[model samples]
Target: MKKILVVDDEFDILTTWRLILEMEGYEVTTASNGRVALESARANPPDLVITDWMMPHMDGVAFIRELAANDSLAQVPVILMSAAAHAPTLEHGNAQFRRKPLSIDDLLDLVKHKLGEA
Candidate 1:
């Protein structure tokens, strides 16, 4: 199964995503803050990461920057989720952008596309 790390401060969003991904056959791990997300990634890197823009302690941009800077975790693909159109510029690699209020089909399509599946 593909592993996905979902980082978001909002419980409802996190829970909602976890359920959605789980139903899609993706192994989902969630973090409520960027700090925990970084730690979890370091401990057990996920194949894909979906993160919220605004977060406590560290933001999504900062988290990805740090992860990209690290050799061990730099290869992981990331998807940035936000209500705004602003997608952060990444140094290591590009990340997929998904806007807020995305439909289930849209989310699944993006996730599958990023995972290199049709």
Candidate 2:
């Protein structure tokens, strides 16, 4: 099974994602913010990460950079989601962008694509 770390400050969003991903057979781990997510990832690197852009205590961009800094985690792909009017720059080649209100089917497909299981 593929492991996915989901980072979001909102508990409801986190829970929803966990349930959805779990039902699809992905081993889901969730963090409330980038800081916690980074720590967790370092301890046990996941296959992929799904994160919200505007989290507190280290945002998505900063988290991606941190992961990139580590040789072991740099290559891990990420899907960054945001509700902002203007999209944030996604410079990480291994990272992808998704706007808020993304459909569940789209999210699942993206996850599969990222994991090379599509």
Candidate 3:
């Protein structure tokens, strides 16, 4: 099973995503902020990372930069979500941007496509 790390500030969003991904047979791990997510990722590198753009302490962009700098985790695919009209530009090619208020089906489809599970 592919492991996925999900990072979001909202508790509800975190739990909801965990349940959804778990149901899809992915090993799901969640963190409330980018700081925690970074630690989690370093401890057990995930196949994919789904993160919120704005987060407390460390933002998604910073986290992605750190992840990219690390050789072991540099190749991990990342999906960044935001409520803003425009998503931030990422330097890494292994990253995807998605608008917030996302549909569960669409998110799942994107995850599947990124993980090559579709």
Candidate 4:
């Protein structure tokens, strides 16, 4: 089973994404803040990561940089979602990005595509 780690500050967003991704038969884990996200990722790296840009401790960019830097976690694909449309330009390599308020279908499509199952 493919694992997905979702990092978002909003509780509702985390729950909603968990439900949606779970229903699609993907194993899902969530972190409410960037600090927790880093710990979780280091503990059990996911096959894919979907992270929000603005978080209290680590922020998405730093998290991605860390992930990319680590040899064990660097192969995992990332899908960055943010309200800011400028986020995609900030990072490069093996990532899919989307704006917020995307439908479940679009989210799943991106996930599937990133995982090379689409």
Model 3 per-residue lDDT tens digits across residues 2-101: 9999999999999999999998899999998889999999999999999999999999988898888889999999999999888798867699889999
Q: How do all the candidates rank in terms of TM-score, highest first? A: 3, 2, 1, 4
Better of 2 and 3 by TM-score: 3
Q: lDDT of candidate 1?
A: 0.87
| Per-model root-mean-square deviation over C-alphas | 1.7, 1.4, 1.2, 1.9
- Cα deviation in Å at residue 67, candidate 4? 0.5
Instruction: Write one digit per residue (lDDT tens) for candidate 1, span 1-118.
Output: 8899999999998999899999888999999988999999999999889999889899888898888998989988888888986666766485766789788788888889888541
lDDT of 3 at 45: 97
RMSD in angstroms, candidate 4? 1.9
Per-residue alpha-carbon lDDT of model 4 for 3-60, expressed as tens digits?
Answer: 8999999888989999998888888999976778878999998999998888878888
TM-score of each: 0.91, 0.94, 0.96, 0.90
Report the poorest 10 consecutive residues by lDDT, candidate 1. Answer: 85-94
Residue pairs that clash (backbone atoms under 3 angstroms), model 1: none
Model 4: ten consecutive residues of lowest lDDT: 85-94
The residue-level lDDT of candidate 1 at 11 comes to 98
In Å, residue 23's CA in model 1 sits off its true spot by 0.9
Error of 1 at 6 (Å): 0.4
Q: What is the lDDT of residue 22 in candidate 4?
A: 88
Candidate 1: residue 113 Cα off by (Å): 0.7
**Index of the highest-TM-score prediction:** 3
